[model samples]
Target: MTEREHSTVVGQLPRTDVSSPLTPAMLTRLVWALWMASLGLLAVGATWTGPGVAVDGLTVLMWVVVTFFSGIVHSYSRRYMAGSDHLGRFFYRLFAFTLVVMTLVAADHVALFALAWLGMGLVMADLIGIVRGWPQARAAGALARRYFVASGALLGAVLALLAWATGETTISGIGAQADALSIPVWAVAVGGLILVAMAQSALLPFHAWLLSSMTAPTPASALMHAGFVNAGGILLLRFAPLVTLDAMAMQILVVVGAISALGGKLLKTVQTDIKRQLGCSTVGQMGFMIMQAGLGFFGAAITHLILHGFFKAYQFLSVGDEIERTQPTTDHESSSMGVAGAVTTGLTALAGGAVFVALTDKGTHFGSGLVLVALVVLTTLHAVRSVVGAASVPAAVRFVAVPLVAVTAIAGYGLAYRAVDVALADLPVVTAPADLTIVHGLVLAAFLAAYLAIERGVYERSEWLYVTLLNATQPDPETLLTSQEEYNEY
Candidate 1:
């Protein structure tokens, strides 16, 4: 290697040395200690069996998820960023972000929660800026910081409204204070919280940060892609009842979320780089989660958040194994099905979903059952297509396997629903208003229209639209994709 190139990579990293105090082992020891403290608190919350500091099912689940995610990413980063000059400092920043996430979820007082929320943004600014030697990384960090400010502002508005309406400074009390508030105050608070949720989660216009985040190490990306990025959905779930009470908030959440989901997913299809693709996918998934939350399907949204977080984290950490995971041969031949497999797949999915819904319907309204059914069918179809796509099974075996897979899937879903149901029972069952039902259809139509436009080259018809989207991701992903050796693989 050339001297200049070696120095370039080293210069791009933070100035730190491997030492006893700065070792990855030492860094993570303290990190794990704090995380274990949270687990102890979790046990206490469970035993209290009464009003406590963010001790409900949702908080407990999130606390555990984030702590474990931190540990996994910490261990992964030990090797992933081992060669970097800033290895020690990187852990410091990453640990700070993870710690802030834990505190935010566990915060009981309104002020403390808000403070923790602000602290997350501050720490993330440092975490994302770890590669300051790269101008592209700096730009991405600045862009993310601006959005973080916007989110903090919105959160501030929400807290002000909450305090004004109920004279309560604790999160638990504010949730309970919902019944005492005037309609106007409640509406304003809910709206603010929705926007805060969107901004924090990088929905659409605020999403360039995720792409820019690729400039950081893969381990930090895993920490983010897995658990940190879901903060918005988590926040919405934290305030699910408030979200459902305001008709305007619900409408805005569904409409904007649908747009983000469609746009983000479409963008993912066009991206060549893995990190950019994953970032776009996260945006779409977060939007879908927001939509689920808006529809008052908090259980499904929480499930989606937890499941997607871990899956994405695995993807980030396993970047070196991508060829094996999606190689389309051997075990990865899932997406290579022919026409017959496709047809059978559709039929099996439909039948399986119908049976699942029929057998498990607890008289759920607002189409919650439909949501669960659609997701189950889609998940089942994908699995069936993958295995059947392998084309190794006899026709008779394939036919019989369909029923077995369907039954197993429904049973698995039943377990998931029960888990989410129990965890979120502390939060009320929120449903969308009847008047907002039409908005749902319009949102879906918009999503379809977007798909068709992108698929049909409608954007190409307009020079500016094409150019804008082509260069849509900010901090110029081109620099990160090319012209930079340090993060190219990432």
Candidate 2:
């Protein structure tokens, strides 16, 4: 291999290697200005007397998340990638991506949304391939480009059909004019758009690019996971009224998302590297998000988008930091506590459902609300179990801790649900149908069964699947971790 090919970081700050004129100071100032502008526009969006703008509470919330997280990523990358030859260009592309995302969320016109949607793909291409000379990074960029281009075309076609149906080019105007569900052609358009979302979201057949993303810098990977992938769901939100008009589109999303979610979860277990594990996690998370959109919980999906962005972004940027991490060690008595754990989480969810019923007259989303309660319960159970002490620990303490954690998680879910429910009341987004609840329940049960199987050593005994996943996901330690050191020697 050539000397330059092996080098991951450049040591020289010589002006000769600079690709773009962007400096640290300039990027910092831009971030500040971007946040300030987003906040101001948010207020305007809420109260603007304009007929074309559709800035709702959810939009404002998403804008804040995108802007705030973009700033965090920019600052972290500036330091983490301090010595890259294309450092200036790197920040510039990230900035551009941030703007495109904000525009995608902010625009109420189909024309503007289309432009921003495609622009995001273009910027993501550059951002993902920021390592420039690396062939693997370039290939990842190519894959991303292919998905984004196809997504953009499908979205554009959907928009054209919408405009044709209602003679309205603006998001709110079209929704105001169309009874799209009655029109079979428009229903077909929405289905096409769902395909676009599937592609853009890295679902199943399209998910390879997401796994290949470790070639990019950590900040870039974080941006894709936390911010970029959510763009697909956001796009769905924009056309949700029409999207909900089609049953086939909904079925497509549910089936594809379920498959992708299951695949991602299974792949994650066997991956040897931390970053690959996170990548698989994202694939699974995005699948669930798509499922949320399919179920008509557009608002809930947006909420997930923002929360997951914060979570995965924090995980990525905080890598290698001196954060306290809990390691799992099983206790003989802990196995016996499974019944208690189940009781705590189950009661917590029941309480959450009760609260929802008491507070809201319109239970338009009982199914999704119930799912939220279950998720909170599951998370709390995991957290509590991870920290469970030896059998010697006081029974009273463990009992108290389990319920307390469950209640806290349930309460958070309830509050977030109520707020989002109110914000999205006018939109068509809600829980899935009653019949699908059984399907969802069965899926969750299966996931739990798999978890127990793995915890109980089923996976360890399965040598073929375990070895195959490890081989596919484990990075070359010498090339990845030691490249910079070796380059320094050279």
Candidate 3:
């Protein structure tokens, strides 16, 4: 060999023994073959006779596409870093694994979902341990450690509780209908686990983790918040039969899901940062799915789960461009927008809390008087917050005046509907569920308005944080690059 070639070989990083493990080509070919096999079966199954087969088969196909794309991206990322140091190699491996597991999850096949979940959990735990063992003062490492620890702890507690509950018949049998016989312990446990995970997926009160986890890079956030986060809601829908068995749990699921759905929508409207907006939107979308499940609309929930996953993944990708456009340009970064314009932007928040309370307590029923009062009060408070918190005059007017105008119009319309029904009624059917439901539906429409307002506020706060806070809170250099352009630009 030439002297220069010998020097180059000797100077390479110490951990350059790429030959010990399976070769890249071998791994790639193996994964590619499996992916193709899954896709082929999915296509065949899609045309099968049964309704359930069509749904399940299509689900399988969807996941195959997700995984196939994820694998391709991972491969590209890996090859780009192939000649880098040991640390680069390690990260590429992790990124690739996360993508593959996420793709497996999207497929929505029960067996594959379980296998991928367990495998990913183990991978995350191992990564955390490895980082902790290293002497590096890495903030990203520290954040990852916290994430894995919290995630594992939460999952462990639920699993243990489930195991104990499964051993006892009392929890399992309590929800059995009078006509039906014993229910499976595993079924109950699975429902409970999914519910807990769904909550932790950061819907409403559990949302702190989504913001905190921003310490991670955009890609990780994209995968976790935009993609995998949807799993919790889907998981619950998968166990809809078991969830319905427990009436109290079912009600809680419905109410909480409703609140989360509205809350998430209200939060997303005003956000400045692209990722945070997407994160809050995910929360809302998941809430909607959970609501469908709670209402015994399992088919709809599954449909939503599949659709939202695709849309959210696309949104996350688009957000990268938005983030790039707003990024600081120098040591003293120029602002993305002028202060006057920023101040003038009015957003409606608190709309969710108000609208949610209103619909639940609409007083359409004889016994719901107190519920109505509570809802009215909550709505008033929302009006107060909107007026007081308004960034501009038009915003304040819309927040306060719009709802008042809406409520007045709804009550008047309801009275008119009732009067007309009564005036025409002595003849045929005076009272019907359809008529009442129609009134209730109108009331529900008002609540939807309020939900939009609340989401606007949430989006604003998120935008503020993303634009200002995230920029200010520089990540630790040991684990993250100073500029996204250096590592992320394709």
Candidate 4:
């Protein structure tokens, strides 16, 4: 059947238009109220002098971010998911997930943290399969649950090991005694935490769960991308002391993160579905966040995740706009840039780099800071490439837009980086940059090669590579909907 016909059939499914006493409007208000409370807490946290485990800047920052995203998702869902079945249940799971995330970030006790982490995974699984009658949703939820369970189990083992080794039940206590632990115990604990972060953030091999989770509603998807996936970065930041104990472990993170970043971007290019494209994008973005943590800049990771949350939330919430396409791009629209455009792009990138270095105080000398600056410059160039290369746009307009966009982006990043750095200052090992090694060099080489190949469309020319990526990105067969009738039966 044609796309329009399928949409018609899907749209014809029964919807409960009759509003209950606890309506979407009511739920929206409730979410806003929670947001307000979180805001107040953030304010109090700024001046909080009392002794507490979870009342630090990191906890309050996360609380505000979670509630803000939750509020946006709820407000969007009120209209986007109107008349949908299980609306109340959706709201319930969403709120629970938000609360669990907040608890996970704020928990100072190892046991409480583990429980909150587990609870988060469970709530997310429920939301993924909110439509019980839909087999695809159920299968998707099951797939995600397996991954999440494994992540939780790894976390449990790590926490138990830390508590046992340090004889400390509290997270801060474990961190205090982490350095005193034996090599084997520390190695195993760190390894487990790495795996937990990998699974939670949907990095590399652990990314299938996220790619297959399209069965979730748009709001859930937003929350998953905006808040849930970010938990990995938060986890890393919270355990920064333990993670930064070993140089090899940090290098491992860099390697894994680089691979996932390149692989996810490649996969995104081949995805036909918009949601799946965004999923692949999240994998790539999360890879960057992990890389930042690996570089001993947990503050940067936090900043990245926060900004990414806002970005992905907007992307998912406004995804309906993607369906309403106008005219397709012609060959002329995809034309290459001229000499003038190239010069402008180069200057814009340079200006972005200077702004980044001046404000963030990175990349002044050699090491990971230099690498970060290079990445930022490349990112700036990429951001403006489309605009500069657009044959339809006037040259003058392209030139003007490139610098304006670059300055804004770089300045914003710099400001956020400073704020996060200060907020996380009380935490140990939050910005311990690892010395560059041969392994890092090799990883950087591979990353650049992948980036070049992607930019040049090498994968498009190589049928083997294209098919490999396409097959690799496919959701599990169990989660696949064979026909509209499968879900339409409800």
Task: Report the number of clashing residue pairs per model.
Answer: 0, 1, 13, 0
> Following a full C-alpha superposition, what root-mean-square deviation does model 3 have from the true structure?
14.0
lDDT of each: 0.70, 0.69, 0.46, 0.84
**Candidate 3 structure quality by residue, lDDT tens digits, 210-327:** 5444434333444455345655654554344445555555445556666676667555654555666777777777776665555443444544555566566556544544433244
lDDT of 2 by residue, 1-490 (tens): 2122332443344344555667765776787677877677655555332444566655666677787888888877766776677778888888888877877776888888888889998898878777766666677677778778888888888888878778888987776665733567776777787778877877776776677767778898888889988887877776776666656666567667777776777778887567778888888888878877766566668767777888899888765452334556663454545676556545654554555445432244555445544544454555565444335557676667655655665556556756666655545444443234565666567667765675576767889877875665544332243366533432
Runs in model 4 lying further than 4 Å from the true structure:
1-23, 47-53, 324-334
Could you give candidate 4's per-residue lDDT for residues 340-438 as a string of tens digits?
888888898889999999998888866777767777887787778768888888767798966797789899999999988887777766788777788
Q: Pairs clashing in candidate 1?
A: none
Q: Which residue pairs collide in model 4, if any?
A: none
What TM-score would every model get versus the actual structure?
0.81, 0.81, 0.52, 0.93
When sorted by lDDT, best at the front, the candidate numbers are 4, 1, 2, 3
Q: How large is the C-alpha RMSD of every model relative to the true structure? A: 6.2, 6.1, 14.0, 3.4
| Residue 29, model 3: Cα distance from true site in angstroms | 5.1
- By lDDT, who's the top model here? 4
User: Model 3 TM-score?
Assistant: 0.52
What lDDT does candidate 1 reach at residue 49?
A: 30
Per-residue lDDT of 93 in model 2: 86
Give the range where candidate 3 is weakest over 10 consecutive residues by summed lDDT.
426-435
